[model samples]
Target chain A: MNDRLTAAERVAIARHPQRPNISDYISALFTDFFEQRGDRLMGEDASILGGVALYHGRPVTVIGTRKGKDLEENIHCRFGMPNPEGYRKALRLMRQAEKFRRPVITFIDTGGAYPGLEAEERGQGEAIARNLMEMSRLTVPVIALITGEGNSGGALALAVADRVLMLENAVYAILSPEGFASILWKDAGRSSDACELMKLTAADLKALDVIDEIILEPGGGAHLARAITFRQVDEAISRHLAELSKGKQLGRYQKFRRIGTAVPKKEGQ
Target chain B: MNSIFAKRRARLLAMKSLREHYVPVGSAAVCPRCGKESGHPAVAQNLFVCPLCGYHFPVGAYYRLSITLDHGSFRELYPKLAPQDPLSFPGYRKKLEAAQRKTGLNEAAVSAVGTIDGRRCVVGVLDSRFFLGSMSSAVGEKLTLTIEYAWKNRLPLIVFSASGGARMQEGILSLMQMAKTSAALGRFDQRGLLYISVLTDPTTGGVTASFASLGDVILAEPGALIGFAGPRVIQQTIGETLPEGFQRAEFQMEHGFVDAVVPRNEMRDTLSQLLRLHEKGGPS
Candidate 1:
């Protein structure tokens, strides 16, 4: 039904029901995947999928946000919007990855961090902050890939890395266009105009230097060609991981220390 | 007869709409908390507290600065810098313009340098009326600069936050301020300087998720709503009725997110005490 498409329309395609999510990507890209759970303080957060896996015969840490296609599964994972526990769990896994000297490959695809009262009560802000701090000090290579919706601090919590990649159709935004419309124009129906102005699509992000690379999707969309999409992502990840693992800027907290150190140049200034 | 009655009804409805559009002006000194009418002088003398019920009315940035800082000690910064619609979202500039005019301030937040009880400090307060104190790009950059300014000057930092969270008009650029402010505060953390975050009435969203919650000594005004998510969203998401007093300062204090709940009257003295406790070479 959504035949007419643009970057904003691709947002729908990227979030298609049958799309290959984090689980599919992990299964396609790695072997001997062993899942880990719990933040060791609170309970487990299903929204965050963390584990050790083998990438190209080498041990690596694979972490990503996952959403279920079914309603029960969606509720279980909070529709891939993590709570404080999920961030803590991700931090714990990242620490393990650091200890084992494995490269960090984070696939971000979330509406945003779960904005629930209990999550904040459990120190959601501190949890996200702690991840940013710890990940900065982590003595390993961090590569972030935006496979779907990459919205705000929730996505950024796992996205501070040496290299950030995005899928062609995936959209990375501060807030949804509807949210933008409501706040800016005082009209939620103005989201189409918001989408046009937001510059949140992959190519837009690349133009703004917010993203490093964009992995091209197959014909139609990733959901239409899952195998090809996964293979392309795999190839890009392998290339980056190999380059990052060459022992450059590893450890030393150098990467994140310099985050936002310079003013982003005005587009076409 | 029916047509005449309908026309009369329409006229009455028009008059009603006109009257409803304007709030019936009330007595100037009516207490918001107790509805007890009084004179302006009495309310002013009571430091804007409702004399009958002891309720603290939310104050703007200037009053916040005056009550918290040494008189005549404040020097404003970043007035020249204003927010730009990075995404160029529709009507973003107009909303900012209207908010600026209404608040009589450049942005939601006002960052400055002042002395708190004779000690040099970087002070910033978020004004709730300015776009409901949502953080636009300027707010983020100003706060980040305030932190950096404190770091550069070796001054203690005390921020009074009253926000509904990140501004939405600027889109992801607004969200980027979270990272920008937090990253700056990360470096500020390395300097070993004190950063006291004072949460006022309501602080939520990206603001709470970033520097607002990263304080070395997190304090909140009595009964303020302080959380990442608003209660309604929490209730809707979990499909459960929230417990009474959820997200309030008292609840947060009990849960370890907030260190203490300070009354507005005692805030200045309490902050002085906190600043003294962390004096140079003082006990950790």
Candidate 2:
């Protein structure tokens, strides 16, 4: 924890092009990755990549918001921003995970839910709402990892997990610092100052009890040492999953229920 | 001397009448959308809707309850629960205090158990005046408690939402409120109790993506703006002119997000009808 990176620096690292993405994590951490596609209600959204896979020889459902590695792919993935279908697809896979009793793991890396004409037309708000309600009650252990930029409800649509973890350099917030700055201060250029105020870094979230743990990245960043980052993530998931596999539904409820500062406790019976 | 005193009294009375004629005080209601002004009493009689253009005024939490609920059938809950500056975020405490002072609300939301047409239900209204009805830790706590109360008491739930989304001042804790409230609703949903969400003008952001959109039947007032992202952000992102009526209540209904665009006057009747229909026995 020496010479900690500034919040803005963390945001930059989180969005760094060379940083490891879901594809890299899926390939490095799991085997027998059978890629799934389509929301069944609409066309497949490549922004959210999900499928059943073998995790340490155990079958688990893996889902993540994917950013394209190149320009052409970025167009295909919409720079990792998901539409309603992407969220529905993730929900379908999570429901499938619940049915099969497979632990669900979701990797989050997105600016937010896509803010476009089509996304709104298709109940973008409802899609994310359904995910939050359903994921909160999932019978199986669910783990969400913030590997990079976890912005807005898009990151949260897939992140209502029993245990939410984040990479050392990852940033999770209600919205991006730039967006936050623009909305609150009416100036996007003040994003660096906004970053410091947003409390978005992994360490900040961890202290606030917003996240369960922080997966330590190698010196420089996860992009510099992908293998170390992957290993840390793998161990963290396994540890949390093992503990969460025992009666996790109520624990998930209590974890979020007790989070508020002004929640009043129940009176005498 | 008596004639002089009478003249002076008449002059003071005339000045008082002139002052009352020019200065309307809080007795005037100005329609922001239509740029028309009406007497406050007339607007109140119309359920706070502009008589000329039909624009619904943003009603506060208590005003919403007073208009919609059965007389003397409301009992407030958690009236004193207030927010703590958990993160000690800069200016957050002052903002909370200012919002509290301005709105007379402990938090953005007011939770209660009330009746409509004598049908008991748990009700909550988010006052946009209170920090833009943004969901902070306390607001979320109040909502979750209200939902859970409905679940436990076998009562239906109705929430009138008018939020700008999660409270940014509370940071991530405010974000987690979306999940907490939704989680409580998830449990309430399993009980088979009806949850009616009435979105007022400008329900967007994290609130819309959570409990506001998770209702069994989603309703919106005429011309309410409902969406996950604000229109400005979307416009800035796409760099294109948006379609007219985009994200409006009618637009949302046409897009199949909202079930109906109920007018302010008809909202109470519609809710009462829905509650009666969902009642245990046959419609009475």
Q: What stretches of model 1 exceed 4 Å from their correct place?
A: A1-4, A136-139, A178-194, A246-269, B1-29, B239-241
- Cα lDDT tens digits for candidate 2, B131-249: 88898898998888888888889999999999999898887888898899999999999998999999998899999999999989999999999999889888988899899999999
| Candidate 2, superposed: residue stretches over 4 Å from native | A1-3, A246-250, A263-269, B1-26
Cα distance off (Å), candidate 2, residue B14: 33
- What's the number of clashes in each of the models? 1, 0
For residues A1-269, could you state the per-residue lDDT of candidate 1 as single tens digits?
22346766877776787878899999899999999999999899999999999999999998999989889999899999999999999999999998999999999989888877668789887787666656655668889999988877899889877788999888898766776677667787887777778888888887766677999988678888788898899999989888887865433234333333343323210
| lDDT for predicted candidate 1 compared with the true structure | 0.78
**Interface root-mean-square deviation, each candidate:** 5.5, 2.4
- Estimate TM-scores for all models: 0.86, 0.93
Q: Model 2, residue B238: what's the lDDT? A: 88
* Candidate number of the best DockQ: 2
Error of 1 at B21 (Å): 22
Chain A TM-score for each of the predictions: 0.91, 0.96
